[model samples]
Target: MCRLFAITSKDPLSPMVAIEALDVMREGHDGSGVGLFLRDLGGPFDDMKDAPILSGIFTEKGIRRLDGFMMEIGFMTKYKLSIKIPKTPPPGVPKRDIYLIRAYEYPEEWEDLTSDEKYSRLMNMRLELRKMGEEKKDMIVFSFWPDVIMIKEIGDPLSVARHLGLDRKDLMARVVMAQGRQNTNYAINLYACHPFFLEGFSTMTNGENTAFIPIKEYLISRDFHGYTGYQSDSEIFTHILHYTLTKLGLDIQTYKHIITPLQDKSIEAHPNGNFLKHLKHSCRRLIIDGPNCVIGSLPDHSLFMVQDRKKLRPGVVGGRPGMFAFSSEVCGLDAVIPDRDKSKDFQPMHLDTAIVGPDRQEVSICRQTEPLPLLR
Candidate 1:
């Protein structure tokens, strides 16, 4: 019963826009936690796009450890934006020494490496930092990537936003996704937050993944280092996306097919029926088996939402030419972009994939019955 809200604009907007929308969408699903993914960054991060930004919470000791580790790894801190928290923060907010987002220059040795190699190193660094933090409860690393910053907190959306000082204009992005978690898992592990990121792909889901174990087993067998963590059942959706795009060279459209394939006659009707049949057989383990709606952003900055056939009214996308948002309820969209034409809003059916290209001009629905763009 989690609420999902994501918006993309031609120009950067403060994260508060999404945060506030999350509040409206919250309804009864308000308190578990809040997770945010900001991409196509604006403001202070625009000039530092090439530098990798490490974002998370840090105890005083953790920050010290992080400084030493970066030096050891050859990363030089270039710029930083440490959120200002008051001595007495909002109620129920956990004690945090520092809420930090810092960008780092790549090690000189990486200058000669290919893009993929550098990405591999970044992922390893994130995992290493996460492992180090877990051992001592010193750091809570969410994302370690270029032009992206993630903030995850266990309080309600607004409280988390205020605690992080998200009202400040310095941190802004053209694309952002916020999730108000339903708290199915009560341990409150921040790592389990939605909108999980890997390499350049990110996704947030709103329902249970009935096929979680099977999908988890399949991803583990891939032996990809990035598929190592499964703190939240929804995390696999992002990995599957990264795998389909990076490993299999399949386009985003193919993702819908792999995760929610058509059966029998439906598949036989597509021009790529044979390919899809073989695909359904080969990747059956990856198909979702229950209610779910996934909202995700690709490396190219395109954003999308997909609904499980069983998920009724999972989400809606509406906005003008320069900006568009997808929300679990239209009220959330109304909360943000009230001026947009209501008639044009799209509520994707069970078989629809609503996508907004990087331009943010319009949402193009890719129905499962239509032929997905050729394999690549």
Candidate 2:
């Protein structure tokens, strides 16, 4: 199993804090890779919250190509920051040519476009760059958004952090999700690392997705451009969230019903049982069939954690007045917020969703409810 760790705080905090906690759960993962995603960014990004920032690794040739393409598309670089790789990386970890996080000014024409239009444009640009990178094998773009940055590397979580110089205080965010990956079914591909992102939704998981094939097929069938990659089964979880909330116009809570709907007998007992039954029958392809613990964040900065119906994986949610964290084990949380009230720590059972809202002021536990019809 892989290990997942996420924290949402009232103030921007360095991801190194979560990485350190992940190191404590080292035994759970084989250290194949470490993936990091940060939102509600701080440091240089705090002031540029409205500018779209692109995060990726590029070779020298790839950098030139990326710049030329961006210029052709009317995007000009406003600011750029690169991770400072350690002078001497650990043995066996390949050296990166360039790790870039750049903010870009939109095309003048884009000023008149609606927010959704601008968002679609950015997604198109990222997808084009990603395809170009796939052809050249020189660039690896992880994310393109205003207040998010993603980084993934092949190595132990702690070593990857040190190599990327993530200990610096400036690399911070109000939300951070980190995964110590243990590849089970696929080759050791960097893109297969956890904390997959699509639009503004991001997710990482700690267990397998036995129903990945159908889920992948279902998502790819959608007209959306971002649903093409299935590097890891866990990526489906992110797409599922995006589909359930953004595509289907359902509440985030509805995701639990869609992904792991209650049994027919149980569903019939709820007020919305008939509606849920229809949803389960119509979207049965989206149901996840393996034991998994998922941690995710929405565009609004709300953080959530859910476990599979069987509760095959371990997850603990804990927080105080200004922060919340979800981890595969209590040891991970203990490393970060040791002083918090242990008595209040929660272990979400089957069919439970723990959500920490954007305010970071409270943790709401939304349990499984009877599927109710959509109130018109």
Candidate 3:
């Protein structure tokens, strides 16, 4: 199993905090890879929240094409984060031309476009770039969203961070999610990295998704182009989230129901039985059957954790006011917030979705057996 670690703070903090937390639970993961999703960014990126940030590694040739395409499409550069590659990278890390995180000004024609419209435009752009890179082995575009940055590489978590120069003070954020990946069911593929992003939402998971193919078919069957990468079985978790919240216009609570719905008797016992029954029937293909723990962030920067129906995976959330973390183990949590109230640290069981909103206050537990009253 891979170890998951995520933290959201009222102020910008180094990704090192989360990376170090992952180190405490090092035994859980095999050091095959590390993935990070940084949102509500701080440092140099804090002011460019409105511009779409294109994050990925690119070869010399790949960046040339990318520059030409951006110019052709009228996406002017607003700001760029430059990384200085170490001449001698840590063992197992690949040499690259550029590790870029650039914020871009939208096309002049899109100035009047709605947020959703801009999201589609950015998604299409990233997909095009990904295909370009795949055809010639040039680029690996992780995320093309505003205020969100993603970095993924195959190596030990700390080594990868050092190689990427991510420990630099400029690479800070109020919300950050990192995964110390274990190659559990597939080979190492950077595109398959955790903390998958789409339309401002991002998520990463430990364990597996036994219902991958069906969920993939159902999601790709939709008109959305961002749902095409099935490189990892765990990626479906993020797509299901984007689909439920944006495409289906459902609330966050409904997300848990879609991915791990209650059984017939449990649904019947639920206060919103009819609603849940319809949900289960309509989104049957989206259910996840494996033992997994999902840590994710919504567009609003709220962080949440969900336990699988079987609750076989270990995960916990703990922090004081203005800061909170969701970790694969308590030791991981202690690494970051040692002074937090241990009594309030929550380890979600089967059918529980623990959430810490953007405000970064205490976690609010929402159990399927006793969900929040806000169910719609």
Off by over 4 Å in 1: none
Backbone-clash count (model 1): 0
lDDT for model 1:
0.89
Better model by lDDT, 1 or 3?
1
Residues 27-55, model 1: lDDT tens digits: 74757788999999998899988789999
Residue 369, candidate 1: C-alpha displacement in angstroms? 0.9
Candidate order by lDDT, decreasing, is 1, 3, 2
The prediction achieving the highest lDDT against the true structure is 1
List candidate 3 segments past 4 Å from native: 371-376
lDDT of each: 0.89, 0.88, 0.88
TM-score of candidate 1 relative to the true fold: 0.98
Model 3: per-residue Cα lDDT at residue 133? 89
For candidate 2, list the clashing residue pairs, or say none: 272-371, 272-372
lDDT of 2 by residue, 1-376 (tens): 8899999998899999889989999988888788999999998889989899999889989999999999998999998876777656786567888888899998998999999888888888888898899999989999998999999888788987888888776688999999997456889887888899988999999889889999999898887988977888889999999999889999778898899888898888877877888999999999998788999999999999998888989999997989889999999999999999999999998878889999988778877673333443
Candidate 2, residue 202: Cα displacement in angstroms equals 0.5
Count of backbone collisions in candidate 2:
2
Query: How far off is residue 341 in model 1, in Å?
Result: 1.3
lDDT, residue 137, candidate 3: 94
